[model samples]
Target: MVLRIFGLSFAVTVVSIIIAALYGGPQAVLLVVILSILEISLSFDNAVINATVLRRMSEFWQKIFLTVGIVIAVFGMRLVFPLVIVWLASGLGPVLALDLALNPPADDAAYFPDGSPSYETLLTDAHPQIAAFGGMFLLMLFLGFILEEREITWLSWLEKPLARAGKLDQLAVIVAGGLLLLTASYIAPEDTVSTVMVAGVLGMITYIAVNGLGELFNTPEEDENGEVVEGSSGGPTELAKATGKAGFFLFLYLEVLDASFSFDGVIGAFAITSDPIIIALGLGFVGAMFVRSITVFLVRKGTLSDYVYLEHGAHWAIGALAVILLVSIGYHVNENVTGLVGVALIGAAFISSILRNRKAAAAGGSSDNDVDEPKPVTIS
Candidate 1:
């Protein structure tokens, strides 16, 4: 199963390494490997969260995810997205932006000898807005999940209280908006305050719009007999796997989520090397393939069903990432710190899940197959 799932990723890793080596020799190969590991480590939680959504998608959409979705993730986010950001941030034309990315300044230089800002500088300059947009979107996701009531809780003490507080309408929006405002007013640079506010609000709105539309158009799954399949729990039925228009929106949500997750990684890649080709090879080819494979593995193996707290862990990690991104607008947060915090949260959750499983086994309860049933909370 492992080989079947990850075979393509391994093959791509070899191909990416070879490309990197041919493009810039052994040093490039090492950089690409490091960047790939970096992306995977940082995005492991992303894979978990993705599985939660991807499992609901039909096989056709799943293939779309592996094919078209990969192109978007690799080129659109890794290569083109950064270039677009540089273009807008620096007032450079698309052609010039592409040129700047390809012909970056030398190491230890922030600007070209001709006095123009390097592609890295332009991208770094754009970080505040990027952070604002991506941070708020992810913050909404985390807040929405954490605020929802669930049959199972990973951190009950905290989650229970939050769930109770969730009874208040639009609390997540309120909190996220307040944070964005606070960050804009005090945390972000004065000149970029307006930009941050606009970007952050847009992020929040995007999340609400996509998620709202998805639920609004959601229809229950039907069995082979055309009977409505009831949810796992008795009371309210679980949201059916989205299809048609709903599926397109959900897929759109996934892409935006991927872009948000990739923001920091794309920006942080400059800290490793300024070679766009190497970054594309590492992040787009090798790292992204593995992430997709991991998502597939989790979905096919029913890992989320088996490890009930994993979704919670991934959300918490996303919350941490959101905060880090917002904070990074004013301060420099190490990518290593971002990666470690996620790993720590997910690791702790995994351990707790195992313990819970063991306890349930001792009680002769069938917990191994239990899945999280987070009660649907209205996102106004």
Candidate 2:
């Protein structure tokens, strides 16, 4: 599995480089490779998060993530997202940005610098929005923790009255969406309101659609052929039917989650070099590769259940990413610090988890076996 994953990673890199070369020559390939690494580094937290949830997905859904998701992430999000941002922020249309990206209308070779987009200007122009976006996301995370800590049961009053109301965890999704929208309007400045709102609505829509579909399509199990009939207590063991609603929602959430993870790196990529094309080349492919790699690792390693805090770490990362995106609305976001903070927290958690498990093992007096701990990531 490791070898297969590596082979695929290598193939992806080679193919991306070849595409870059064919389209824009050697410089583009070099730019892409660098961007790819930067993206992967910026999004280490995302890999961990993907590992946690991808494990829950059906094999078919997992395959979609590996094949289809990467395409949207690299080309659509990394390469095009920036331009789209600029287009929305300023009156510069995407076509104009694309044109500028292809052939920068700069006179001096020093400024033109291999015909890359003037990412320096963009960096200065977009940092506050970046900072605001990230800041808001973090606030949401912290707020969520506080809210979760509260004795707010899942519609406790309503559920108690109506026993068959079913569990209502959708509040978290709705609250997340509402918070994002509120942040977009008030927390984020005038400029990035659109971007943050877009992201929030996108997330909320995914959460709602998936869950609603799951509920709508869920059956009484026994009617389906060879199915594990679920009667809330005693049921045979059969893979529950997927109405595709849950998968769709998971896909949507995963995409948003991926976006949240990639935001810091996307913004930070400009700091590495003031070349948008280079930024795209480096971060896009690398981010895509990491996503693919994590998916494979989770499937093969079977380590998701072993590391409980990893998912927690990922959610924290997502929260952090959301804050980072929000803060980008109005402040300067440092890539190194952002990456470091997440890495440190997750590392601490991993250490604590290991220590806790060790203590438990000692108390139980199990055989002298060392638990294989998964590595910690820098981001969620």
Candidate 3:
């Protein structure tokens, strides 16, 4: 079953490794392998959150996620997005950016020292804006999750209070907006403050617009009494049936979510290697495939339902990542630190979920063990 689901991903992994080997031999192969690992480490939490959303979607939309969505994630965000950033940052056309990437000059050979400020350098220079946009979008996502009233709680001490506080309407937006302004004032450079602030605002607005659009078009269903419910009932099968225009918006939301996760991964890749092609080939291919595979596994196996608190943990990890992204704008956080924090939090949550399930099972067994099943009455 696992092979059936992840066959394409395994194929892509082989192809990516072969391409890496062909391009730069053994050294390049090793680097691609390392980058792929790094991308996966940074994005495991992403898969969990994606599963949480994907399970709510219909099978058709889920297929879209694995098919059309992967294309956008691999090529659109991983490959072209950085080039677009460089083009915009350098005030040069896309062609010039592509040229510079293709034929990088020798060290100290061009006008600027060390090969005319490599693609990595250009991207690093634009970090403030990237941080602003990605950080804000992620922040909104984290806030929305934490501020929602949920029955289950992973970290009850923290989450319970937040859920209580969520009663204030739009509190998440207000808090997120205030934090953005605070970051702009204190953390952002004086010259780039306005740019960062604008980008952050835009990020928040984008989240709101996407979320609102999805809700606006959702087809309400009538219950037995003919009362209209906001969304379809039951699992993915029901969702798949009713999803139409709203499903498209949901697709848009997932793309944006994936982009927010990729933002950090893309920037972090430069720390390992500055070659844009290598980054795309390694992280874009392997990272995306593995994450998608994990998402499918969770949905097919009903992992979320079996381990209820897993979703809670994933959301908490997201909240942590969102804050880390925002803090990274001011401080130089090690990529390892960023990745490990998420892993640790999610791991702890998984353990908690296992313990809870065991406890529940034990309690249920204790109660029912003494109760005998009714003796079968045989008709002679």
- lDDT per residue for candidate 1 within 1-380, as digits (tens), equals 78988998999999888888788999999999999999998899999888777766656766777789999999999988888888887777899778778876465234334466677888899999999999999999998888878777888889999999998999999999999999998899999999999999999999999888777666666779988776521111134566677677778888999999997998888899988899999899999999998888887777777777888899999999999999999999999999999999999999888888888889898664464443321111
Instruction: Give the clash count for each candidate.
Output: 0, 39, 0
Winning model by lDDT: 1
lDDT of 2 at 216: 51
Question: Which residue segments of model 1 deviate by more than 4 Å?
Answer: 105-116, 222-239, 366-380
1-380 per-residue lDDT for model 2 (tens digits): 57766677777677778878887787777778777766666576677766654544556777787778888888877778777766655445678666655665555243444543353465356655444444444444333332332121222344243333223454455556666767777766776678657655654554445435544544433544856544411101112333365555556556755665665677677666555666666777755776668666754665444544454555555566666555556555677667776776566656655665677677985323333333422111
- Determine which window of 10 residues in candidate 1 has minimal summed lDDT: 231-240
Candidate-wise lDDT, in order:
0.84, 0.57, 0.78
Model 3: residues with Cα > 4 Å off, grouped in runs: 107-116, 221-242, 365-380
Better of 1 and 3 by TM-score: 1
Candidate 3 positional error at 316, Å: 1.1
Model 2 collision count: 39
Task: Give model 2's TM-score versus the native structure.
Answer: 0.68
Better of 2 and 3 by lDDT: 3
Give the lDDT of residue 311 in candidate 2. 45
TM-score of 3: 0.90
- lDDT string for model 3 (350-378, tens) is 89878877887878752221212112111
Candidate 1 residue 75 C-alpha distance from true site, Å: 0.7
